[model samples]
Target chain A: MPNKGDFWEVNCYNNSLMYSHHTKQKSLACLALLFFHVLLQAQSPENDFLRSTGKIYSVVAGIVIVFAGLAIYLWRLDRKLTKLEKHINDEHETS
Target chain B: MEGFTDEPGVDLVKPEGIRFPYRSILNETIRNTFFHVALWMAMFSLYLVGLYHAILYLRTSRKDHDLWSEAYNKAGILFGIMGIATGSLWARYTWGSWWTNDIKLNMATIAMFIYFGYVILRSSFTDEEKKARVSAVFSIFAFVALIPLVFVIPRLTDSLHPGNGGNPALGGEDLDHTLRLFFYPSIIALFLIGCWLAQLKFRLLKLSDRVLKNR
Candidate 1:
């Protein structure tokens, strides 16, 4: 037979393991609750319809293109200004 | 309805699931995350650029550095205002009020006042060199003050805002994976736009300076 000390030690180890396992499962359940909340929010019919038709991407593409164009234009303007500043400094020095 | 994916890279996780996380009140308005959070991030970035120019002005006493600092500060303040406006709207939608007694909000207001004072302080000095020196020093001090006021204090105490007071509103289980794609881009876009605005303003300041010299 196992010694009394050995028995208690094994019992304690099992109890601690059980406790941790229980907590882990509880936390997992909480995560599921949280994701369920997100799922519910996304259940709107109109939003679903738009996504299903892939039409939402047209809007996304349009926005992306416009913003990209604007960024390019701004970058060119910045370069022009830098050149102008250099030209002005040259004129002033020559004068 | 069938889930569709015309774009290959876009999410097709579920027929009905939005790839973004959601809280009850923040449901659809979670889209505002791009605007509200990105504006503050952009503002902080622009302010850092401004502070760098401010330090450069102090070191070199260059007129262009002073003007650049002023332009960056103006753009930073503009984004700050946009941040506050978007935040207030988000607050009203979720927290049921446009303003609240939250520590973060109050501290942010104080930070704005400090920067605004920096502008007024600069304008008060008649001498150009004196204005640049004093304002540059003030900008450095204000930025230092902002760190503790806006960021540090909020984390150290209980807060109703997400990511504070043990709230699970921002990290781990809260921020959805797909949102990162849009969120990061929003920050980059806003920062670029703010810098663009600053550059434009800098050009105007330089042009006016040139005209004044010519006259």
Candidate 2:
């Protein structure tokens, strides 16, 4: 969990926000400081608790369904652009 | 659709191989950490990209930069809608409410409204230069406002969301190494998806502009 104080810096440290001089650069400076703090913390991964019997995979499945819909939207958009490009090409060739 | 791969890679499964840490209320839904949380991060990143392009448009007054600015903003808004929808569902299951008075939740709604205003403000002007200039300024102001509304104020106040009230949700108190395995990659994947959407929109915008010029 990240703290509320340096949360902005932590989120931006790795993102591609070149510089805003006024607003962005200041956040970048904060990102550098928080990067070190996250590194030094040690935590164990092992615990003998709940396993997959709880149907967590259903949640994952639902998410996949949502993304699949997004994929279809992209595919249709790509097809429309392709058709437009072909029309533009045909016009140029005839001219 | 015919050539589309169903998923990136099959999810790895083995008996007693690895497991996500369990919490009382968030037991199975902890897996949502990978998807729901990552969606918001991707939305934020796309907004930053939009903000960067808006700044470029203002500085150079380049037509290409203006198109790029609008394209990324559109992608960011799309992802933001997804994020809000997913978070609302998760809240319903976990927080027992479709919407809450939680400061973060309310602030996020306000942030979305601000971006929606950008779209409305941008579309009202028919003159290309005027649209670009005014929307560019609005993008800057909107992003500036977003930083505080989504980031600063939520943290300062008590929020039901983790990373508030001394509960860090990432790799902190709630997240474990096993969850990190899925969480980090999910954020990158969603971020790439947002970028791809922006690029597709930019290409379409450029082609339409060319068509208009030729006409």
Candidate 3:
């Protein structure tokens, strides 16, 4: 389903329009991956050095989760638009 | 500014303690002074701008003024929310919980809800003039209510947050000379950022209005 408050997606009529969102999607994914790597290190005994710094770093984890959620949301937006594009293209083909 | 060399009243050498205070429980998280506290100041500045525009909209009946007011209100709400998030984190470390029952926090939350009501009131109207008129009125009242909810009522009663009956704000050792240098700048910086966000929102609203008008 189309999401609410989708201003950019409203006027998407070309490939570049979709790719604009695709580029952001990748960046968001990379950021989440970077956080994942850091969190992985934190799980280890030897690499748990960040634990000594206190609760400030947990805010970083919260930020990572927010970015991850945005990435997922963008992926869903891409999928929804692609489905609509396919439907329109199929209709043109049958005609 | 970088070297502080030959600057009067500023210790060029290792003369005095100017770093963040080592408060119990607060510790290094006192660094949040720049982020959490400044955010509220920024939010307050944005809401003040919004309040001004709201009155202008009422006086001139210009749709642009109404939109500008709404934009600033939106930006103010965003900063307020971010302030809440950063404050929650700071509280977690210092207050030992994510939230607590305090006059300050509760009143601030109420202030936010009143601002949120402005948005709801704006969205409720389908007619352009009706929305603008009501939104302008609502935003003005929201900001007026915000003053007491955030600043006045909190000081009247006891609060775990600073600026309380006993714990006077901007008076303690928590904010030192070094912190003052960064904290004041952060408020202005974040206030500019909030205005920029409001400008962006205003553009978006104008675009949407134009698009819908064309249809």
Candidate 4:
């Protein structure tokens, strides 16, 4: 009787702890990348130099969009970190 | 009775502690993955780089370009070994075989061997300048041959390797969206890490050259 309850209790505890911290951080990064990817796709030119030529153009366009999004995200992240650093330095000076 | 009896005041000895950072993403095992993917990507990237150096060697007949060409060729071979080891482990899990004669697999093997011969050709020459020049020419030829062996040949034949003759490389039901989510990031991260390692290697080579000349 004790063993049965022990197994059930363990299962319940495991179910509650669904996502780990690492997985959460990875998910956030993925979401940021996907959001930028969608924005890029929407803003992409219809009569583009590569896309207008052939089927391979779509593949090329997709690659360009993904990389551009990645670049933009990295740039913004760098800027945010710089601002955070400056804020921290200002606080230190004030104290 | 003596063997079974415990000595008075005897204490169990514990092994030395090795602590790893809790937040660190890079571990000893994860480092292997970096080497694996980096070598493959570097092998591919350096092949292209060597191609450019080869062209320069052919057109200009400059020894510096030839030196760089030989360096890239050497780097490519080193990475190829890492790639094959990583791929063999990857295959064990995914393909249920350590080695397969799949079109892509065979093509990659041939491409690696072709570059291996490039190293052999360099060693065959005794004269420094002549060795570099001949090696550069061979590197260029190997680079050209790589295009067909690694890419075109695999694409022309049906095989289990991703993005070969039968199916699109990243497309298809095999690499579902779930896998792509992790796979794409892995590719980019691994490629960047590869470049970093190659730069380090090139710097070490330059330093070693200086040391050798001084001695």
Best-fitting candidate, measured by DockQ?
Answer: 2
Give a tens-digit lDDT track for model 2, residues B1-215: 01212122222233466755545555567678787788888889899999999999999999998889888888888878777777776675567567999998888899999999999998799898999999999999999999989888887767777445443544264456787898999999988988988899999989888897887
Candidate 3, residue B162: CA error in Å? 4.2
Which regions of candidate 2 fall more than 4 Å away from where they truly are?
A1-58, A61-65, A79-95, B1-15, B167-171
TM-score of each: 0.64, 0.71, 0.67, 0.50
lDDT of 2 by residue, A27-93 (tens): 7667645564553231111111111334354466548645864776588788979888888988899
Backbone atom clashes (below 3 Å) for every candidate: 0, 4, 0, 1
If both were scored by DockQ, which would come out higher, candidate 2 or candidate 3? 2
- How far residue B34's Cα lies from its native spot in candidate 4, in Å, is 9.1
- lDDT, model 1, position A4: 37
Question: Which of 1 and 2 is ahead in TM-score?
Answer: 2
- Residue A59 error, candidate 4, Å: 28
TM-score of 4: 0.50
Distance from true location, Cα of B97 in model 2, Å: 2.4
Which 10 consecutive positions of candidate 3 chain B have the poorest summed lDDT? B1-10
Model 4 / residue A61 / CA error / Å = 35
Task: Put down candidate 1 lDDT per residue, A1-95, tens digits, no spaces.
Answer: 22335434544544554445565877756655655554444433333322332233323333454355446656766786777677778778988
lDDT against the true structure, each candidate = 0.70, 0.73, 0.68, 0.55
- lDDT of candidate 1 over B1-215, digit per residue (tens): 11222223333333455454544434445556577777778889999999999999989999999999988997887777767766675565457677999988898999999999987998799888889888999989988998888778876677766545543344464455567678899999989999988989798778867855774
Judge candidate 4 at residue A10 and give its lDDT: 44
Each prediction's Cα RMSD?
21.8, 19.6, 12.8, 23.8
